[model samples]
Target: MSFLFFTAVGLLAATLGSLVGLGGGIIIVPALIYLGPYFIGKEVSVATAVGTSLAVLIFTAFSSTWSFHKQRKVDFRSGWLYFLTCGPGAMLGSFLTQFVDATTFQLAFGIFMLIMALLLIFKGYLKPVNVRWAIQRTYTDDHGAVHTYGYGALPALAIGLVVGIISGLFGVGGGSLFVPAMMLLFRYPPHVATATSMFVIFLSSIMGTVTHVALGEVDVWMVLGLAPSALVGGWIGARIASSLSSGKLLWVLRITFFLVAVRMIWEGLG
Candidate 1:
């Protein structure tokens, strides 16, 4: 019963995560820590939850990146560029997790999610981060529409560094920060940004997972329960994302994020 329930959680997490290049750990980590005791009669530490989530994200990112690759939406060159700095940052952040306890993790995650929700709410009102640097890139969608986008190399690397640290620290896959920055600051088309984000996440998750494994934090049983659904959900999410505007979904996510954020903060305060 627990395995089945976990499978369902994985499906939901991966579907939502992949659809937006989120890599599913945002959902998985919290669910395992907060809901696990109630539903599965087991409680996991933050480190175990994060480690397990990152392991499962490996499959989700691969599946989404493959789907996006087939659509020709992924920008491999840029993904690699971002990963250059992101890799080491992942290692750095993973080491810092040992200092965090469950309540602290809950409080911090809640604050982060609150910020994410606010970003979604005010994204339209926000201006692009002004920068003088540019590295030109182009993509052609399935319908033959050409789109050009680029981010300053230094700025992107810096952002990727922050994102990698966040990914390892929270096991969130970093799309919460990546996608909006790409679309807003870099002027990437929605599909292109999401596809490319997944590619970067795949690399980042691997780095984080390795660190977690070295720490003996991973839960093999949780990974086994979540991985199959992750594979299915990632592909499905990419397909859906490729076909439609994510406006509605983002709105839903904003509410969900806000609710989760409040839950975490309140519980942490208690």
Candidate 2:
């Protein structure tokens, strides 16, 4: 009976996380730690909870990436860069988990989310509808080579490190931060940013999972049970995102980010 309940939660988390690019940890961690144990007694450990969450995320990331690939939106070049930075960062963050309590990490994450939410809300209100992302013609660089570019690598690297560290601490995929950073800092299209972010998440999550395994934190069965549903959810989200306008997607991102922020604050306070 308890397993059935967990399966249901896994399905829902996959669905929501896929659409939002969150890898379901934002929902999974708290739900498992608080609600799951509450209903099932003290059977599960914190390590199991975190491990299961990552397992589900693995599916979500894989599914989402495939979907994006079909749309030809996955930019391997930029994604590789994100992978290089985010993967190491996640490992570093996960190792530090031993020093700080999850509650403190959650609170700090919550504050970060709140600040992002405010900026999004204000930006939405302040920006004119006429303002849209414009695609400029490719430019030539030194050596007379023509390239289509948006922003520099230094900025992307800096942002990736920040997001990667946050993911390690919170057990999130870090897409929430990655997407916006790509869009705002690099001025990439929304879909492009999202696709790239998912790819980066794939590498970072894999690294984080490795760390969790070394620490004896993973629950293999739980991950297997949750993976299928997460895949389905990712496919659906990718399709929906492909069809929607960039503005609508931004709105969705904003609301979800705000919720994430509130949750973080609550976790920190606890």
lDDT of each: 0.88, 0.69
Best by TM-score: 1
Colliding residue pairs in candidate 1:
none
For all predicted structures, in order, the TM-scores are: 0.96, 0.80
Question: Residues 103-203, candidate 1, lDDT per residue (tens digit)?
Answer: 99899999999998998899878776655445887787778888777788888899899999999999889998998988888888888889999999999
Instruction: Tell me how candidate 2 scores on lDDT.
Output: 0.69
The collision pairs in model 2 are 107-268
Superposed model 2: Cα runs more than 4 Å off: 43-48, 119-149, 245-267
Taking all chains together, the TM-score of candidate 1 against the true structure is: 0.96
What's the lDDT of the predicted structure labeled candidate 1? 0.88
